[model samples]
Target: MTEFNDKQIDILQAAEKLFAEDGYDGTSIRTIAKEASVNIAMISYYFGSKEKLLEALIIHRTSGMKIQLENIFKEDLLPIEKVERLIDLYISRINKNKCMYQILHFELSTKKRIMDMNAFKDVKYENLQAFTKIIKEGQELGHFRKDVNITLIPPTIMGTLVHFQMNKPFFEPVLGIKTEEEYENYIKNELTAHIKQTIKALLVHEN
Candidate 1:
């Protein structure tokens, strides 16, 4: 498990918040230091540089996901059930780690090369490969469509969740959402159900 002192965690949390608000390129070491309530040298000492800090943040956010997915795979359940569990797991994690998810989506959409760098590429590939195995196994078991593109499924799932998350301000009035708790409930329940149904349809829909 990746471990961080309380101060390191504070710095990371501050960075995540700043990255969400300011964009990665716009946020600087000085800003992070101030937000984190640490001196500039402390960040440099703990994380080396801004790039390495970003990498550490990614690692911290994603380190648990692969293991969780692997354990879900080991469960004695049907392929569709496993897929449903995976969906729930993802939605739960993403909601809890919204900042990390936002940062990840931002980097992927605008700074593709950053995701491919040595820092994040392995974890990304490992996650993709793990999900690929799940889908392939489902196909082999005659549970999922053989023609489904496993490569696209992860992005599709993530994009759907991120869209709903990032558009809450625009959607709230339109969708009749009134309060933060209600909006969170909508995501935790209704939106999650929507994603589950959507994924199920995609996996089983006739081509």
Candidate 2:
């Protein structure tokens, strides 16, 4: 993953916050400039336009995750252990970048037809292929059931994590949590444990 300079990082952070607060259509170059505390020309100079800025943010955040998952999949560990580690990686990444995920969830849900989702789709496809390779290796090694669908596993894992994040208003109160930090901790530990257990069961269960 390429390291972003402090100024670029500042712009991406500001864009993420604004995109979360206002839909992409509602956010503007001027707003981002103001929030980032940089002039409008700087944003244009860093990223050509609002659409491109969104793409850059998504790429920057997801690149590290892709590398981490690829490394985990390549680790000389048991298939089952690798699966557990993959779950941990997903939860940790999503929890750390809640804002980015929020933007993703919102964009797909509300602006699917209009927004340029090509970059996002490409990244998602690449990650899914990497994950499928891991699952296939496990099946070949007799660690996972042959009947398990590779395609469904990624959505199963991601959906569960994204659900907890997007439904915070509903879940935080249900879980009886009051602060964001507490909720993050619960997701990182308790929720992560549950997801790992569920995935392991699905992978190893007998027909």
Candidate 3:
């Protein structure tokens, strides 16, 4: 992972917020500069161009998760335990970086391409590779089903979280979630448990 100075971190955060609010095409380098309280030249100096800035921001936000996923395999735990830890790690990261995740979701859902898709997909693939390693370990241990479709695991986890995020307003009212804190707690606890349980069922061998 790349180590960013305070200025670079500020600029990336500013870009993240702007991208989430205004969409990538609607935001400009000048807007990010103002948001970060830095000159336009600073962004150019650090990231070169808008496309590179977006790529850097995506990498900055996601690289930690990928690293953590890789580190999970080194921990002293059963394969199933490692998988559950991955579920928790993902939920916590997504919850903390809501703006960045929202930016990614918006870019993916829209027809107009604003950011570099390949960069985004590359980060995702790295994370998936780490995740697949755990699943394969479990399969080798006779803990997970051999026939499980490993490719679908990421989507199963990400798609459910995306659906919950997109439909929060509907879900909040239906679930009687009356406050922001309540909704966040529900996501971190209830939603995380649900996803862990779902994945466990999908991956675990039948009794």
Candidate 4:
């Protein structure tokens, strides 16, 4: 991941917010500059183009997760504990970066070419590999079942969280959420616990 200065971070964040709300085609470089309180030239100087800006934002948001997942492998915890930590890490990251995920879902759904698709896919693949490494270690250690579908685990975690976020308006009422804090707590607690339990069930072999 490329290092970004304060101004660059500001521009990327502005782009993320606009891209989530207005769609990539709807958002312009000028709009991002205005939102960031910087000039168009600054955005151009920092990112080179709108497409590059989107690329930078995508990498900026996702690169950290891959690094964190790799670091989890170094921890002295049990395999299942590490898996639980991975779940918590993902839930926490998605909850915090809802807008970025929203932009990704929309862009990928529409099959847009606004950003570098290969770069996006590379990040995703790397993250999946990191996750698969943990699962393989668990299997080798006789903690997790050998039959676990490595490919499905990433989507299972990501899809569930994305679904909850994208359909929040509907789910909030159904779940009896009334305030912002309450909703946040529900995600941090109930939602995280649910995902952990679900994944553990899939991986843990019954005696």
Q: Name the better of 1 and 2 by lDDT.
A: 1
Among these predicted structures, which one has the highest TM-score?
4
Q: Estimate TM-scores for all models.
A: 0.87, 0.88, 0.91, 0.93
Candidate 4: tens digits of C-alpha lDDT, residues 154-177: 789889988988888999899999
Off by over 4 Å in 3: none
Identify the candidate with maximal lDDT: 4
For each candidate, what is the lDDT? 0.84, 0.83, 0.87, 0.88
After TM-score superposition, what is the CA distance of residue 150 in candidate 1 from its true location, in Å?
0.7
TM-score of 3: 0.91
- Candidates sorted by lDDT, best first: 4, 3, 1, 2
Q: TM-score of the candidate numbered 2?
A: 0.88
Model 2 spans with C-alpha error above 4 angstroms: 1-4
**Lowest-sum lDDT 10-residue window in model 3:** 111-120
On a 0 to 1 TM-score scale, where does candidate 1 land against the true structure?
A: 0.87
Candidate 3 residue-wise lDDT, 1-207, digit = tens:
357999999999999989888888899999999999999999999999987887788788887677899899889999989989998888888777778888777666775655666766788898889999999999998899999999898789877987898888899989999999999899889998999999999998777
Clashing pairs in model 2, backbone N/Cα/C closer than 3 A: none
Give residue 77's lDDT in candidate 2 (0 to 100): 93
How many pairs of residues in model 2 come into backbone collision? 0
